[model samples]
Target: MSKKLLATGLAVLTLGSAPMALSHLVKDEAMQSYRQSYFTLIAMNFGPMTAMVKGDMPWDDAKMLALAEDFAAVASVDVARAFGPGSDKGTTRAKPEIWENTEDFLEKYAALQTASKGLLAAAQSGDRAAIGGAIKETGGACKACHDEYKAKDYLY
Candidate 1:
């Protein structure tokens, strides 16, 4: 390879890996906020989900459907990959269990995805019974992963 081409390739590789490399070393408040946002997304979804599963509310199907869609929007990102190797910042509430039990964690997460999508479809079809069933299954997915992976401090 030409010297210029080789140097360009190295530069591209470094830039691509920079986010993972710097996540732990950097103490920027913005990075902290971004990390917090992921947690917040989970919290936001769970709150409404609990009410729906318990039938506490009037069963506003449209609202639940909308939230399910929104949940999917945030669920797709793999923050684990973003953190790369350097992402175990002391501030990170994400448990090392996430890495250790990656396959199981991913399976549970996939269950959440499937359940949420089912919830949305059931809501759209105006099937209250299906909605309840999907909600319960989705809740199970969340709890299963949380029981094993998330930190105790965050659970309470």
Candidate 2:
């Protein structure tokens, strides 16, 4: 092949892959902020329901269902790409084991998703007792992951 032609071919190959590489880099850069925002949203949805379940707030079935639905919607988001390599950096409580022990992290994520569904179902049923039980179960699922995958004093 001509030297000029060979150079052109190599340039084409490098440029062709640049977008994919850039995309991955962007994802990694955004992961920590995105993950933090996502969890904040989840907490926003969870807080009121927890208060209601604990009798600190008056029970409102409509509000309960709406919050549960919101929680479920957030839970359903595909976060598979949100925990990419180096995502444990910055202002995150995420443990390094999340990437090292990926399977366990994924399992915990799945359990949280399942619990969200159960909470949604219980909320839709309009039974305060059922919703309370579901909340407890869901809280357990959250704690299970938090205990192992989150660092204490991480927020500070």
Clash-forming residue pairs, model 1? none
After superposition on all CA atoms, how large is the RMSD of candidate 1? 11.0
For 35-101, candidate 2 gives per-residue lDDT tens digits of 7777888899999999999999998989999999999999999675789876677667888878888
**After superposing candidate 1, which stretches have Cα over 4 Å from the reference?**
1-35, 154-156
Which run of 10 residues does model 2 get worst, by summed lDDT?
20-29
How good is model 1 by TM-score?
Answer: 0.68
Off by over 4 Å in 2: 1-28
lDDT of 1 by residue, 35-136 (tens): 567657866975686687686766676787777777766766664454444454446656777767778877877777777677667767777788778777
Per-candidate clashes, comma-separated? 0, 0
Highest TM-score scorer: 2
How many residue pairs in model 1 have overlapping backbones? 0
